[model samples]
Target: MASFNEDGLKKKLDDLNMSQQSIQTVSLWLIHHKKHAHAVVNVWYRELISATDSRKLTFMYLANDVIQNSKKKGPEYNREFGSKLGKVFDHLGGLRLDDKSIKGLNRLLTVWEERSVFDADQIRSFNKNFNKDHSKEKSKKRDHSKYESKSKRHKKDVEEFEEIASEPRVRRESELTEHSPQDSTPPSDPPEPEQLIEALQELESAATSDAVVREKIASLPDEVSDVTLLNNLQDLNAARALSQKVEEALAMLEVYNKRLAEEMEARKSVARMLHDYIAYQKDLLAQAEETLEEHRQKQGKVKKVREELKAHLQNLPDISKLPNIRTGGLAPLPSAGDLFT
Candidate 1:
């Protein structure tokens, strides 16, 4: 229920980091306020333009996360970001980026293209704009390297392009393997409060919220458990019908019990996550308090030193009140003989 505005958005961006959790947290915040998608995208683009080169890619990752994840929720973010990406690429094309940054940007573009995040024509347009400068640089390199054999040069160029193009596929595969629940190790960082809340909300009715199912469970016939009632069965057909009813009741109860068990496990997982997250936060708070105490001590020492210096200065003769001696009125130095006497 947190409200979103331009200032809050900027503050979030200013603290944004490359960690997946950090990116996802901010993305969730933005998507939670999808009603302001237009303003959010505009602010996002503006910040991206002003961000240091090191942080620019992080901003793009955030955008990617929001646009892709918000699609199921609504098209607002995707549409808003889509409308601005061409200009974003154009701005990026003008910057003097290192090879790594260039490669990262290329990989993002590749992801968009492969996933059809935008229409083919729009993506093509974005690529053309983004790579305009890079293409020129490559052309110049090709021209300057005319002394090299054509086959060798072509091979080198192809290899470089392939390396960049193949990275997303390799990364995707590694991520899939890394994130498999069966193989996933505990995350190194604590879960954010927002993440824990979202997780708990998912389990709010995980055990089964069907009123009909609960009602059926509550009204289960006593015949299901009353073995003595078998004496009342007048024929094989009656016995068979009662037996089928017992089997059906058993099946329903089994299914509901399984659901309840799963829900229990889910809640336990969330509890573990919350426990870890709270411990982490408490540790951080302790560290912060220690730092504050250290700073307070230092400030006190500095203030004491300043006061002593001020007192020393105040007790000294004021230079301004002292008579100013002209060159002719100044006392002359004594001779070495006078000093001995």
Candidate 2:
């Protein structure tokens, strides 16, 4: 942007009046930048607050253009126009929105902002700054967790941040639009059908000179006469309807693909658990089989001892046929009886 004295800046704004297309080009350029975009939006906000413009609607229109760019860009350009709508509300908050039209615009911005995907850090800060009403409720729910050691708490925080970073977040088609549409400038009625057809025909024949193309470009401010212009303004409302539809389909497909990945991961976990369980059962079975085999061997040894004792009893002589042998008397005929037997 050209650095301009106060007069120079006013002249530029004046020159932009007859050219809505120029306003859009300039507006999007400024909004895509951080410091410049905020500065531009703030300038408009100040103008609205101070009522500096003789024609306030003119400034309102420009401001609305800024917001509309952000909305159309959506989260796809989040870094460029981060929290710009919230900045507008910085001044426009509270009872000032009683006007029905302002209320409508405000409602539109609120919806757009809700659909937007903000940075996690910025969101945390916003809630921390503005969510005082919930503080009491949170305090009541607070547990002895605060008493935990500092090291453990730090570890927990690190884990949570890692988990969030690793988590698969699904951004919708709306996420592509960074700015909100504050004022929806109705498209000028297309040139009468006859004139449009003439323009189309003119477009078909190649211009022999850059002079003619430049003349056409410079004439009546500026226009996107071809693919370049259409692509440049694709972030705007009607231009994006088709692209946005395509984006919606892609987002849904992304969510489905992520869900399938998670399901597969869970399946792998269950399979591992089953494998571990089977190995544990096998160990127990082996221990039981070994114990049974030991018991069988011990029972076989005991049977062998019983059989040996029975054989020894059968080998002993009968008491009735044997010669008498008392504790104190001699067995005189033992030898003769043995010989007769």
Candidate 3:
């Protein structure tokens, strides 16, 4: 594990042109470490060339070493418990190690610690002891607080119900006092208890029907295990699965379309290359042909000149080199020779 200063790491990366994969890996680690991740990434972009092979590998190795070491350090080293750490790493490398491989790594580390290869066990044990003590204290406080809250809520509900129940009694008592019992009092129907119950039910139903309930239910904790909650969850899961399948199909279709587009682009590129190559070859051939014709015409002119000179020389009488000016002097120019010769 290295004590990496962001400045030092950037300097090292700049010295070597690292790839994007390497940069992203380092940036994510900087994030995992809870130190300015994006700032570090920007620094990397500003400093690193992003083209050097060794630079990428270096960042990747350093990041892996740091993360592994941090995890070994303690729970404080762990980020949000359910964070998608694997996805981050996978995206950086453009490769994925499956669940089994990851589990195997965990198992290997556990075995190594158990074998007393290092002081990992002591550190882990200390962390566990402290965490347990803290958790127990926290739970006790929370439980007592929750108990008080429930008691208060129960008292409030009872008071509200009692006030409601007393309203009808007070009305009846006033009516009886206002008129003598059975003294020519017209019979008036009082609201039935069932009607009140029905109205309450209707109010509750309306409240549940509001869109907010759907949102709240959707946000409920995944750990809920109550039977009704579980049933609703299962139904929701089925709907989600169907939606996911539809989304997957759409994604696959998009990929297919993109691939088709790329293939078409590739074909066009090949065609253009072929056209350029053929045009170049054709131009070369035409130039070569023109040159060959010029060379052939020159050769023919040379042959004609030689024939004329030979005729002129043969026409001259055989004379000793000194005597005949026609034969002894330098041969006449082609134009100076007689037409017949």
Candidate 4:
């Protein structure tokens, strides 16, 4: 394995525009002793760390090198690198991405992968390790935007459901305000269990209608916040049970929303088809009108010729007064009286 001394590594990384701390953060992932004796400890370690995306690209390139060497020389190259990368990301402090630079990062990885420039096994191992650690941290993770839903353009059903849910909330707010003058009051009752069941049923129906059913189920924890109050109830076990049911319902709703999005897209396609057909028909109609006008002009010319021929026929001499002319016979010699006329 080709190795880099500290100065060589620094120069290479600097040329790639990596900041000092960014180098340090990624350095935590360096494990191939030939390259460097340094080893990584953790991913997020409890504080939000700032690193430009360029640094991450540099990290990925270094990673590709480390992993490739490990595949050919030793498996530890992939093993240690993935373990450290997973830890850092699993507990990621926070990341601010430059959307513009994201394109470059994506392109770099794509080109590298296409060239078979790195060990595919190393990439797979990293992903596997990351997901394993990610699953372990789910319960402790608070920022619940995994698989974030798309824009409202595709969220019709979800938006409608949210609207329905917010109505009773509004009424509760009014009641609270009306009774607020120097008086302590009991909190409003949680909605009836039947209402929850109905909502749950609606969500389940939606889920069944969706194409990506399993993904909807997986993202339920992140999508449902209204149900969390169930966990705070006095009867913890009952609350837990209700929460589970709500979670199931949320999964269904997510599925249904995705189905709705699909339906909307399908409708747009149909609309476009109809529009194109109408335009095509209009073009055909225009061509037909042009053809009709051309035919009319030709018919007019034919009528003029027929009229002239009729006039010529009306002006012809009376053949009954003249000698009969037979086919293939010479015409009668002109009389001397005709020649004089």
Backbone collision tally, model 2: 14
Q: List the pairs of residues colliding in candidate 3.
A: 17-52
User: What C-alpha RMSD separates each model from the true structure?
Assistant: 9.6, 34.0, 36.0, 29.5
Residue 45, model 3, lDDT? 40
TM-score, per-candidate, Cα-based: 0.53, 0.26, 0.20, 0.26
Candidate with the larger TM-score of 1 and 4: 1
lDDT of 3: 0.42
lDDT assessment of candidate 2 = 0.43
Clashing pairs in 1: none
As a whole number from 0 to 100, the lDDT of residue 285 in candidate 1 is 66
lDDT by residue (96-203, candidate 2, tens digit) is 222222323333333334544454565444344433343453354355465246435445433432322222122233532332222233221112335444544543
Instruction: Report the error of model 4 at residue 12, Å.
Output: 63
Candidate 3, residues 1-341: lDDT per residue as tens digits?
Answer: 12346664554455432333333334333433344444444454444224343233333333333333334334332333113233333332332332222222333334335544235644354334324334454466566765566455445433443322222112254555464433433222222335445544544434334455446545544434233443554577775865575565556556555655665454433433344334434534664576589889999999999999999999997766555575667665567456657
- Number of the top-ranking candidate, with lDDT as the measure: 1
Candidate 4, pairs of clashing residues:
28-40, 43-87, 43-88, 206-256
lDDT of 1: 0.74
Estimate the lDDT of model 4.
0.44
Off by over 4 Å in 2: 1-35, 52-64, 67-87, 94-98, 114-341
Per-residue alpha-carbon lDDT of model 1 for 213-242, expressed as tens digits? 889988988889888877898999988998
